[model samples]
Target: MNFKRFLKWLAPVSLTAILILCTIVQGWSAPTAAQTQLHWYGQSAFKLTTPTGKVILIDPWITNPVNPNGKTDLATLNRADLILVTHGHFDHVGDAMTIAKKTNAPLVSTADLGQALVESGYPKNLVTLDTQGNFGGEISLLNNEVKVAFIPAIHSSVIASDGSPAKYAGNPGGFLVTVQNGPTIYHTGDTDVFADMALIPRFRKVTLMLACIGDRFTMGPQRAATAVGYVKPDRVIPMHFGTFPALTGTPAAFAAELKQQRVGSRLQVMKVGETIRL
Candidate 1:
């Protein structure tokens, strides 16, 4: 065969080979059909698993009052990529240090609270500035698979010391987590229903809201329903309630209020240790 004829045949074959290789690479790089899983442990403790298998725990009070299998759940936590704490209270900060040490998950919180956690014996290496942010600040993490925004909350944050007086942690806040292929979750840490809650939808559409409906420390059913009316998320999951006697708010009351107030958001009352695929 002539050299020119050979080159022409080789060029077309190479082009076809290259096209096939590109298709294979694209298919391999594409994500699988893995659904995001959200597990509620009780009293605001939740484990969120992304579609790519990254795990995020928020207010990890794994051993709270309402969860019967707290110890087992804590022991079985094999993977955790991020641990987010809205405040320094024992309930919200519960088992964070242990989980971080075990999984090497970085602590994502306010700068002051992160430092306070380090001082309180949390792993110093994991509480870096890369994961810390203040209210109205947002940080992209996990190769842009997730974005966490710190939102203000009308509450107090003090880290209790063993011998010394309780130290100021930082301003209390909430978390708005936007997952790449998953839902946007808003965790309203221990806070009363504030007017600014209405502004949350201005940033992004919230898929799920973890609200606090316990009366003594946070908003009760009525106020929480009002807050839901403000945020107007697609679905609302009640949290920070039913762990103590003072937390008198019930999910039934919340649902009734939602109906009475004419809110369009759907109420999802997750059972302890239950995992919901989103």
Candidate 2:
């Protein structure tokens, strides 16, 4: 146990201990609590609040033909701690940039999508942004308790103009969001029930799922129910329905299918502007 040799061994060990301690302090004590509130603004838009009060908005397509009075259109409803875009559809990004400009929130999306937004009129100076592509990659926010993983989905990823081909923006995707204190939430932006749905991270363990059951464009009630059966989330919230008359699928139909398939108990049908707390 010579003095020089002992000191060399102790140095690395001490540094490792300090690093681990710092991570724990930063993740737990730095924030008084984990996220606690889950608010559904209809369709795929939702507001999540960590116990420490950090806000996260997902696929925030608040105003459209369906949600005419959506918070996105409301001037007072600006600002968020973080914003996530599942894909490049207009309904999912209508008010994202506006809210970011007003609140200076961080935008979490794919690199290609973020760049496209910047080119398509989003303010480049008003917000922070994080873009991570799908599978395994995660972004830790709100003191690291909340981790967001971009998951795969079968959907379109184009910003088309009148009579023009869809601009190849990027691949369409979904989100697998885990909140430390509450339920893990999944927002499947207009998608079909692909085999990959079963492979998405945190599948079936989700507490709430914002699913698209609008048939003409996405999966119909029967398929969505099957998607739910595969995901087996603790609860499911049907969305992307009733927005257009062509979208004949309804929550009622989803509910009936869920019951027929023994999943009705987990379905939570939210009103256009209702909030669901998990």
Candidate 3:
């Protein structure tokens, strides 16, 4: 073909190719629909992923007695935007400092406990004032993708230093986490059942309740079932049990109690290292 004819043919063809390439690139770069996910690591440790992919860890005792893969889970945790510590017990505060250092995730707890953790070697910069709150206070975080409300719990909280006496960390509490476009979750820190629990459902409808059913430390199956009746969550997952011999509150017992109480909530018993989509 002549040069002039070749140029004429190349112009439209090149334009068509550019348009097709642009379309393909745009499609590939577009954001995908986000789904919320939850992971339990036995005891009271739980990992929650918001629809926007922000990660939140509650009572992050990932390497607990019941979780055989606790070390693996901790090592593989790539992202953590916030770490919510309900109390200062060793089991509940498991690996918080290590995880905060690794992921640079800020600490969300009562003002006193946050300061105590900082004194106990958690990164001072990560446990800033903005991340701390007291009971009845709610903090909006992760660009408003999550709202964490500090709720009271019937338990004790003391922080013990290395080979030293235990000191008062703060009042014990639970977390009422509201995720944007996702389910609202209530993690009842280490506590026994209280009548005030009925007040929780008045504020927000609970999607899932992570309840402690271990008898010696927290509420047994009977009291836990009663607590569930008060909060009235759509689903209930038993935790803080089967880690030690004293924690004899089995899921079977909890299920039987739930049936006996005629609680409408569905009991979801998650195994160690299991992840579920909400």
Candidate 4:
């Protein structure tokens, strides 16, 4: 009613509005969110850290032959919010049960593969319907900080325990991992190049594609290059290569193939024990 009363109310309201606008408008003024981090442990194993610091491990073969520091990495890794196994192959499932037993991170995979993992010594209770899904099915986890969609991969999957026969686990698949305020990453689990990979970009643009370039098991450089062309990610990282004498695919060859295919994705070749912010 009074002029003095109105002026006091407007002053506080204007200051509050200015502060809110500053946070909303200023990109360079202050750091709004932390950058996502990615760590490679040789082979297809990777540790993805969200901007909010939640950890997701995909195909965590930490102690693969190529990673000289695998033992140390495995020993020192104490935190994992989620353990995502793309398949039931020994190499891809490496150290997952050990990590799960220690960290109690839930198993994210198809129901069959999850059951196999549980039988193979993973914490039984951690394998739940919420984290397991089939191809084309998407599940939001980590309080919605991360969302994962199972995508098809042209590969086979099986599980075996010590002194036990191998059993067919489930259909092999890859993962489309979307991190909040970070990036969408496609981890191609031990796959050959398939035509349907082109369909991935129609649903959500992939920021990074973690591709397999090992020749004997997965696609070599040339085939992987085609997969890169299909996915058309902003950046592509070659994985599952040079981990053994059999895995002769090199990043150098991969780069040449990418250039030959005229693929526009940036090739980010990470070292076995290196960590980088994305």
RMSD values for the candidates in order, in angstroms, are 6.3, 11.5, 6.2, 5.5
Q: What is the per-residue lDDT of model 3 for residues 6-66, given as tens digits with 9 covering 90 to 100?
A: 9999999999999999999987865666878999998999999998789999999999978
The better candidate by TM-score, 1 or 2, is 1
lDDT of 1 at 16: 97
Best by TM-score: 4
Q: Write one digit per residue (lDDT tens) for candidate 1, span 1-278.
A: 99999999899999999999999998786555898899999998999999989999999989987888889989998899999999998899999988999999999999999999999999999999899999989999999999999999888998896777898999889999999989999999989999999999998999999999999888899999999999989999999877988889999999999999999998998999899998
Query: What are the runs in model 4 whose C-alpha is more than 4 Å off?
Result: 1-29
| Candidate 4 local lDDT, 80-119, one digit each (tens) | 9999999999999999989998899999999989988887
Extract clashing residue pairs from model 1.
none
| Residue range with the least summed lDDT across 10 consecutive positions in model 1 | 26-35
Clashes of each: 0, 4, 0, 0
Question: Candidate 4 — which pairs collide?
Answer: none
Q: Name the lDDT value of residue 190 in candidate 3.
A: 91
Residue 12 of model 4 has an lDDT of 94
TM-scores of the candidates in the order shown? 0.88, 0.79, 0.88, 0.89
Model 2 CA deviation exceeding 4 Å by range: 1-35, 71-73, 125-131, 160-166, 201-204
